[model samples]
Target chain A: MYYRSQYPRDLFAELDRLQREMQEAFDFSPSIRGLARGSFPAINVGGTPSSVDIYAFAPGLDPASIDVQLEKGTLTVAGERKAAEVPEKSTVHINERFGGAFRRVITLPDDVDSESIDAKYRDGLLHIAIQRKQEAQPRRIAIK
Target chain B: MNMNESTQVAKAAEAARNEAAMLPPVDVIEDTGGITLYADLPGVPKDKLSLQVEAGTLTIEGEVALDVPQGMEATHAEVSLPRYRRVFTLSKELDTQKVNAEFNQGLLKLRIPKAEHAKPRRIEVKLT
Candidate 1:
């Protein structure tokens, strides 16, 4: 059953890539500007024996402005990025940076303890650590 | 062929390699004073960043650091750790000597002032 469901998911992903490529081919502006439709605030999630760590890449954001929350085995990072203000009498040649409110939700493993979670933002990256529950930890068994 | 042509070709090849790694998004704004460039380069620290200008060409490079936890494997991975690099050609009217740079939260800001001759000036009226 698992192998059967995997085929269609891979096919759907391939089709989505094709559609995006076709859109880029038709739209000459993005190609000329060399811009790709990349997602905002890219993230990496990994875990250790006792805890799970999530790293979010978000530049040009104030650390104090970001809000992190965990509930129901889901972690959410929300924040706003302000647009750069152009000076008076200055003409803008090219404007490409996007600024606005953004929120990213990540579903964590059920073994994580809801009470032992810590989050910190530093050097344009947000790091979140969630401890695993005591019951979920590995134990050594002795041979008789 | 001269040395300049060979160097140009080498630069182009380096740019191609950079694009394959990661292309950092940028915004260029021109004002009366000069041009301001803003680039989004997350996960890159100040020490790992590089900025260079030569023969009216500006280049930026940054290395991203990824710290995975010890003894843990990633079951689901989406983000790829790639270095950031980009280049831009500048006009002769801009003064490279007066350029300024600042990095905060992995965002790079470059300010290039316009040359004196390129700036606007008002001539005083004289009676004959």
Candidate 2:
């Protein structure tokens, strides 16, 4: 099975070109480093002998809104945060906090086993655990 | 669950907002090398807070509001913008002496430059 749209003979290639342009624009991370603008969530990465740990820091964000997935050695985090209501009578002097939607995508090392990833959210932090496959584990070799 | 705790926190937050004249809360993020912080000071002027990194800890203490807004009264307040208080433990890989901070657009951006060797670098793949 494949996902490709076929167009009329005259517009076949042109439509394909347009689709490519749209894909490029819609792609989450276009940069080589994969960093995007607007409120990048903080992340902490640690690894044990058998697994790698990743944590994302996001306050005031509901856990239900968070989406985490691991595929092709890339860890993706997508979520939205709504603005808190401020009463009409309250006069505001300073408004610095940003409210809206935020999405962050990170690329992981090749050693991670995509299917074996596990995750949990707590205390405004999303913790993800990816266990390494046996072949990817570190092993000491004896000299002859 | 954090969500359940947040409700209780919300109540406490509301109370704190009523008690304090201002709440200058700061969100902090730290990595293996250094720490970055975002402090929300709605009415705090440039001259209020002095940013300094001494030894291995960052100190951000500042006064938020000298006087309440001219024509405003606190009723059912939820935003507890207090005096900004945030502390961060810096890693040894950070050069605390050269830390820099700037406040613009109501957001304080602090750049604690990391040591040269602490940054990630690519290693060449060679074939023998």
Candidate 3:
């Protein structure tokens, strides 16, 4: 495993590139670590029969600054987490929080209805729900 | 090399790797009077966060509640850990009894003041 540097930002970028290549090679899915590497804010994608749900773990950010875009069956969440305020003349022992701009893209299933989407931000978690196509939903036909 | 020992070693390494993913990043700042600590705890609400100071030790624990929406099951998930845990030993010079904490926008801020006795003092001298 080769890493560019100890800084989390660069390290994550390296992992992201690696993961993208792997994804193309083997159709890999993001995990907790390894391919995912806890990039900036972690993301989770799930779905129900009627709608697709996406939960993005983005903390310490203003909801107004976040940009959400849905285009061509792809959803993108982009935002910047401002650096926390630190008092002057203080000794900083440990600083591990990643600060700066970040963006995440999630590709939804083809059945997802692009017209209907709902998003909310609460407790640092951004949740997006997109309705599925009516024709794609599972159906039980009455016995004739 | 014992085979069982090697297996145990691999398991320990894997556990460490997994734990690192869950460890919340924290910043500890120390000034003359005391120390201020900040932690990023996303998706954790006030009811789910627990901060405890016991026997000269401070522990921060936050649990992320993933409320699966009604009739929805996760199809793909990247974040798996539900809890964040971190522990630290406080300096004896600091007053543990008076610790202030506030959580807003998923960030936890804690301030621990220095003990009264630990403050700097100067003595006065008179000419004889």
**Candidate DockQ scores, in order:** 0.44, 0.02, 0.39
TM-score of each: 0.76, 0.41, 0.76
Q: Candidate 2 chain B, which ten residues in sequence have the lowest lDDT sum? A: B71-80
- Per-residue lDDT for A67-133 in model 1, tens only? 8989887888888888777888887787666678878777888999999988877668788889999
- How does chain A of every candidate compare to the true chain A by TM-score? 0.69, 0.67, 0.74
Query: How much is B109 displaced in model 1, in angstroms?
Result: 1.0
Best by DockQ: 1
Write down the RMSD of all candidates, one decimal each: 9.0, 26.8, 8.0
Count of clashing residue pairs in every prediction = 0, 6, 1
Off by over 4 Å in 3: A1-34, B1-21, B120-128
Can you write out model 1's per-residue Cα lDDT over B1-128, one digit (the tens) per residue? 79999999999977755453456767788888899999887888899898999899998988887665778777543345357777799999999999999999888999999999999788999999
User: Clashing residue pairs, candidate 2?
Assistant: A94-B42, B22-B81, B22-B82, B23-B81, B23-B82, B24-B82
Instruction: Considering the two chains of model 1, state its CAPRI-style docking category.
Output: acceptable
- Model 3 global lDDT (CA atoms, 0 to 1): 0.78
Clashing pairs in 1: none
lDDT of 3 by residue, B46-106 (tens): 8999888989889887888876778777766556567787889988999988899988867
Better of 2 and 3 by DockQ: 3
Native contacts recovered by model 3: 0.70
> Which CAPRI quality tier does the interface of model 2 achieve?
incorrect
